[model samples]
Structure formats: structure tokens, C-alpha cells
Target: MYSIHRSFADNCMAVTAPVRSKGRFTIGCDIIEADKLSNRLVALLPKTLDLRAANAVRLGLRELLINAVEHGCLEVGFELKSKIAESDDYLQFLLERQKLPEYRLRTVQVEYEIRPQRIVFRITDGGKGFDHKHRTHKAREDDALAHLAHGRGIKMSLRIFDRVRYNTAGNSVTVLKKLA
Candidate 1:
């Protein structure tokens, strides 16, 4: 396959956010970019008045954002990622994947709307989604601190968001945090 020939930073520069009464942020899978987007989104929510609640939302948002990037856009499998994490090639693998034509252009999108009672976030990725029917909301609380990398974010997200729903395709997830 051919390469896209752009640096991750270059791709991140293309992320576009147009703020208003509602907000949307289109982003690449880079962690720095994801964290930044999470922070920006949380800042827009007045419902997170308590510091602890704000932090929880921030953490969950970041986790799901990374999930969309790695599992969805980058196409890194759970077992394969675990295999790489125990070695030194994981970073190299991600870098290589990010240059490939199929993966390089894929992106994760985060759209948010503030309703009278809650804030909703929809994070969608450009990849073939896995089967998610078997995934449970409480699947990995015990594994949250384990050496495994893939399951904790989703678990944390379930705890933080008031509601979490996944599309049948599994590439898109929607989360809500209540205001009152």
C-alpha cells in the first residue's frame, strides 16, 4: 500500500473546531490531540461545576476519544495491541499504520450538544466497527488498573457518563452527562 506522507502533527493541524451554542471537533487519533479536544469540550460545559465531576468527565472523554482513534481509526486489535505493549514495537507499529493510505486518512469525530438537562457527545470513527453486542457496561472494572490497555477506557467511560450507547456498527458511541 502507498503512504500518506504526512507527519502526525501535520494531520492534527487539519483538525477543525467551530465553536458555537453547539460544538464539534474533528480530530486525528493522536493522544495529544485527543487530550486537547477533551479539555476543550469539558470547558464548554457549565454542568461540571464541581472539580471532581469535571475531572471525571475529562477522563472519560479522553478515554473514549482514544478508543475511537486506536480501535477504530488505527485498526489496532485488542489482542494485537496487548501483544505489542509487552514489546517495544508498538509505537513503531502505530507510526507505520498511520502512514498507510487506508489508516492515515481515517479520523475520529467528536460532536457535542448542550441540552437543557445534559450534555451529549457523539464520537464516531472512520473504520469498520467490530461487533459490540457482547460488550457489557461493567465488563472491565477489575481490569481498570491491569497491565491491559484496551478495556479500561471503555469501562471508565461507562462510569462517568450518565448514559452510553453504541451504534450497531460499533464505530460510533454516544455519551451523556447530566446537568442537574
Candidate 2:
């Protein structure tokens, strides 16, 4: 397995990659501060992944990072009304959360296992967990206004992965997709 770690100079954050590999890969652990995730994403794009999978990887990673930072780390109930008031409200909400002492306690972890046919990406967050059953059912029904704002991530993730699974607490998600 390959490992990489980066400590952001701008903020109270560090990005650590404990494991990364292409063939027969396994991502053991990665800890990234919530505030620096986007910057890390920008830095990680060209180095860690191939060009062919970059777009899908970026999209998937963006959503996962947002979910981890917003809902998981901040414990903000996903609210569609706030989004309607301001397109960037979700981002602002995250920024506010970062100013809080609680944000310092949050970290996002991504683990993976690669096989000949597929790759599995698992993302875990440090936060109060949500009920997976209720969230999944709400997602399936697609009847809530919050679904309009929050549902897109799940839809996008499903398109990018062959299969997706969430832990009972909804703080972790596993995505699997076959290699081309």
C-alpha cells in the first residue's frame, strides 16, 4: 500500500493518507480536517488518481466531503429552506461550523479496497450518527423538501458507483464500482 500525508499551512488541519494503491489496493485510514478538505481535493486531484477516473472521483469525493463536513461534523439538520434562501448557504453554514470549537474535533476518513474487477470506497466521519433507515426511506420516497437539496448527492453517488452501502448510523458510506 502507498501512503501520503499533508499538513495544510493555512489552517488547523492535516490530511493524512495511510494507504493508497492502484492494483490490489487497500486504504487503511485517512484523516482530513473538515475545513481543508476542499483544498486537499484540489491538491490530490492530479497526483493520486488517473485522468480517466478523475472526474468521477472528484464528483464523488466532493459530495462525500460535503456530507462529512456539513451534516456529520456540524450536526446541522439538512434543511432545504435555508438553501432556497441562499444558494451558498450550505457553504456558509460550514464556514460557521468551522469557527466553533467543535469543528476542531471533526475528521473525515476514507478507506478503500481494490480488486481486479472493482474498487470500494468507504468514508467515515467523527460526529453524531443519524438513523440510516429513516434517511434511506426518506431518500426513496423523495417526498420531503430536504430531499431536493440533499438527495442529489445520493443520486450522484449511485451513478458513480455500482453499489452503495451506509452504516447503521449513516456516518459512514461504502461505494463500489467495477473497473473499466
Best by TM-score: 1
C-alpha local distance difference test of each model: 0.75, 0.56
Q: Which candidate tops lDDT?
A: 1
Across 85-151, the per-residue lDDT of candidate 1 in tens digits comes to: 7887877878777788888888889988976577789999998987665555345446644555567
Per residue, candidate 2 scores C-alpha lDDT tens digits across 43-161 of 33223344336447556766776676666766766564355436656555555656688665666676656454556667777777777666655555544534353556665676676
Estimate candidate 2's alpha-carbon lDDT, on a 0 to 1 scale.
Answer: 0.56
> Which residue pairs does candidate 1 place in steric collision?
none
Q: After superposition, how far is residue 48 of candidate 2 from its true place, in Å?
A: 14
